[model samples]
Target chain A: MNDVLDVALRLVAVFVCFLVLPLVVGQTEHKVMAHMQGRLGPMYAGGFHGWAQLVADGVKFAQKEDVVPENADRRIFQLAPAVALLPYLLVLLAIPIGPSEGAVGQVVDAGVFFVLAVMGVGVLGSLMAGWASANKFSLLGGLRTAAQLLAYELPMLLAAASVAMAAGTVSLPGILNAFAWWWVPWQIVGALVFFTAGLAELQRPPFDMPVADSEIIFGAYTEYTGLRFALFLLAEYAGIVVLCGLTTVLFLGGWHGPFGGDGLGWVWTLLKTAVLAFVVIWLRVSYPRLREDQLQKLAWTTLVPLALAQIALTGIVKVAIQ
Target chain B: MREPTVVAADAADYFQTYSVVGVLAVVGVLFVAVAFSANRLLRPVVPTPEKLLTYECGVDPVGEGWAHTQVRYYVYAFLYVIFAVDSIFLFPWATVFAAPGYGATTLVEMFVFLGFLAVGLLYAYKKGVLAWT
Candidate 1:
């Protein structure tokens, strides 16, 4: 009974956090991007700094008509967003949100691989969404996303593999416990490769050709509307949170704050994640999206080789330490 | 100085970790279902024929929507398969590398393995598989 209650409570907390995250992340992105572009952002919705803009947007999204194209594969169209969004939520399970040892959802043995593998499945959603829409542009967008994701996933895995090599374990907390302050300096190249590959995997700016609105008319999401569209948006923000969390856990030394002891671990985790999230948003504001071919070329040639090299370097250093 | 806690020692104990994953998967699916159902209850469904048509910048879409995609995408998948094999080796290598007595010999062997993979990539590069048109 106690185990059931504990699991239920954890689920509730996870659900609540996932629910509230999109509103906060979306609003922050809007305000930050507005400031970067020197424009007023959301000053009206909730009076103070337009904090309730996302809430208003949520209400609006809910109330809009759910439109399905006549030619679309209706079954696949409805299922695509759910499939895409499902992985993000599952990816959360393998990750530790705070610094405490008990902060993780479960102490899975192959925790790192679990998280990355689940996250990789999200591309199926995009691919299905684009293909089912039955629009040329949507098909193009889906194809681009499929190819782009396939390319980037390799480097991302290699980068994570290097970290796994360094930490001597693939579990999240095990990785955390193995770390001191020096892990960053020792594996800075892995850190950079992971972050860069993560950015592309998340399909954020400079790698967002999957849904380049200018060329592909929102790509796979061209036909998605109302609640379905909201699900996709929610998934993207949830993805940002997951990527940032993974970055924190793997690279930044999860939950280890400079001043306080372990009590404030979640706070440090949150702070680091927020900074990474902000950097994700900042990159969105600053860089123009890469062309699809350019994006693929990057993953295949540059990141793949760099990540492989980092793994080799890590292996050498580990042997040298013995 | 603190000893790391072992998550599990046996198969039964390890399965407990997967139960948590199952719980998470349930919660995720439930969340989406309830939210969409709620929106369905609140939102109006006034679909017009025009709105139901494929969007094409205010113009009616001509011909069938499905079109031919670039062949370059196939090549990308081919490369992915190569790296997928490469990554499979990495996981085991990582586990074995930390074991006692598995020292420079193992490291050098892995590099030689990677050297072969690099040569494959170089071959692809020379063949212009990496080129973008």
Candidate 2:
């Protein structure tokens, strides 16, 4: 049937995006970070500026010994990477890539809540990896992750709730349809809070104390090796793509361009997401990692309050306009 | 007869949407499994005692792996629980807040709810539970 074919094609596209976007982001990070530090990165791997560096890296990882620590709970340690990697793939299914109904992989009515809930499941991956590793550093890293999640999760949720409030709908495409140019400045505070909290949730730089390589020896992933470690690395990059894409949808007017139509909408969406992804990498190059205390203080004292104010402002303006 | 059929169709549609996510999850797991199995075939696995030992900067790992972690983290977990429950109410309130006549009332009502949560956060702050030390 046509319906079945349509579903199959969409899944294939989502799966392909899930595979490709992360590698692109990863490669960007390698070159961008290298250039920022005054070096050329991976110029020889694929002949043309090392275009295939990540592919080569993947090949190399496949041949490395899959080292599982003897003291680890082998099953959970092995399972952790898949757990971390799958949520982003699932989240990608609900993201609207264009204005039309066909743009999304699967149109869930409550897409916002679905994405948030699914993304939250990724925290467990790190926790499992940390606890099952049976290493002191791994356990500390896992505990740090739990604490970090507790601090950042609320602000993220609150910031998201502000956007949902403004749009008066929880669907991703519905939010896009409701988006007006003015919502940019109006929702700017919530956007910043959401992006920051999301970065912390993904354990990205500055907020990456959970896996602070200098301090924790890569935290929950300390014992991971070979393809298993590579999977976790892939999950981190995939997470960057999802977060940037979601920020684009929720705040920056997904699929909306200066001259608007359903045509070329996907292009605008991808372009905005790529720009946001650049900002994420640029941020990594710019700031020193925040100390644990400072990270928590910023989330609680600054982001949470700012998110609350943004929500109040949104409510007042909505009522006033009515 | 017509009503039951329509309801069944609606239920099927709901499941159909989620089934895509289900398939994607399965595919994700399979992607990793395939890569891993490929590695298993290609990689040399000559494990030694030293290689399997818990890595601690090339030194012998000391003490038990399950070292006593600071109990301070428990407090954050507790706070997360309280706030998470509170935020769940905000979603429905958000929908109602933008409705034609419900705007002002929902705004006031939601603020009261947030005010309570803010008080809870303030109490924790006053008690130094927010302090990392």
Candidate 3:
């Protein structure tokens, strides 16, 4: 039937986006970091500024030996990559790329809650990898992950709740429809808190104590090799895409182009997301990793209070406007 | 008759939406499985004892892998539980706060709730539980 075909096509589109966007972001990171550091990155991989660098990397990963440590819990060790990677794909499904109904993969009623809850589930993947690997560093990494989750998750939730409160909706599309220009400056503090907490949740640099390579030897992924290791890397990039996309929708006025037209809304959404993704990578290049104490301190003493204030601000403003 | 049919259609659409999510998850797992199996076929797995042993920066690993880690951040976990439950209340309040006539009342009520949460966080902060070191 036409309905079945339509659903299949949408799933395929989402699947392709899931596969492609992460690689694009990964490639951007390689090139951007290289350029920032005055290195040539991968000029030779695909012959044209390494367009096929990640493709080559994929091929290389496929050809590399898959090694499960002798002491690892074999099943969970192998299962962790899928666990890490799948949640982003689910989160992507609920995200609205434009104002139209067809722009989203699935129209969940509680889309904001769905995305946040699903994203929180992804930390378990690293925790599982860390615990099951049976390496000392891996265990330490797992513990750091749990600690990081504890520190950052509350502010992230509170910040997101502020947006939902400001918009007066829990649905992603509904939020987009309700977005006004003043909401940007009005919710700017919440936006920043949400983005910062989101970066910490994704365990991106500066908040990447869980996987501090110098200290913990890649942390929970110390034992992962070849394609399995590559999948975790992909998950990190996919996470970047999701976080940027969510920030775009919730705070940056999803699909609200500066030119004032809805027809090219998806383009505006993608553009804003790309710009934010660049900032994510730029932050990585600009800052060093935070120490454990500093990480927890910023989340609790800084982001948490700031997010609470943003919520109270939103409440007062909403009441005043009414 | 039409009302019941409309509700049934709405229910069907909801399930269909979630079923797509389920399918996407399965496809994701399958994507990994397929790539892994392909790697298994292509890669030369000549695992030696040295390779199979856990990596510890080119030296032999010391102590048990499951060593006694300090539960220094256990308090964070406890804090996480309290705040996570508090956040659950905030979500519904967020939706309710914007409704007409409920704005001022909901704003005052939620602040009281947040005031309590702030007090708890303040207590933990003062007690030094929020400090990592």
Q: Interface RMSD (C-alpha) of each candidate?
A: 1.1, 1.1, 1.1
Give the TM-score ranking, best first. Answer: 3, 2, 1
What is the C-alpha DockQ of each candidate? 0.71, 0.77, 0.79
lDDT of 1 by residue, A214-248 (tens): 89889999999888998898889999988988989
Across B58-88, the per-residue lDDT of candidate 1 in tens digits comes to: 7999888887666578887998898787786
The DockQ value obtained for model 1 is: 0.71
What tens-digit string does per-residue lDDT give for candidate 2 at B1-133?
5799899998897898888788888888888888878888999989999999998777999987888876677887888899898897888777768798787788788788878888888898999988888
C-alpha RMSD of each candidate structure in angstroms: 2.9, 1.7, 1.6
- Candidate 3 per-residue lDDT, tens place, A1-322, comes to 9988887888888889999999999999999999999998988888899989999999999899899998899999999998999899999989888878898898988888989999988989999999999899999998898889888889989989998998788999999998988889999999999999999988998899999989989899999989999999999999999999999999999899779598899999999999999999999999999999899889989999999999889889888887
Which scores higher on DockQ, 1 or 3?
3
Of 2 and 3, the candidate ahead on DockQ is 3
Clashes of 3: 0
Model 3, position A247, has a per-residue lDDT of: 97
For model 1, which pairs clash? none
**What value does the lDDT take at residue A16 in candidate 1?**
73
Q: Assess each prediction's global lDDT (C-alpha) against the native.
A: 0.85, 0.90, 0.90
TM-score for every candidate vs. truth?
0.96, 0.97, 0.97
Candidate 2, superposed: residue stretches over 4 Å from native: B1-9
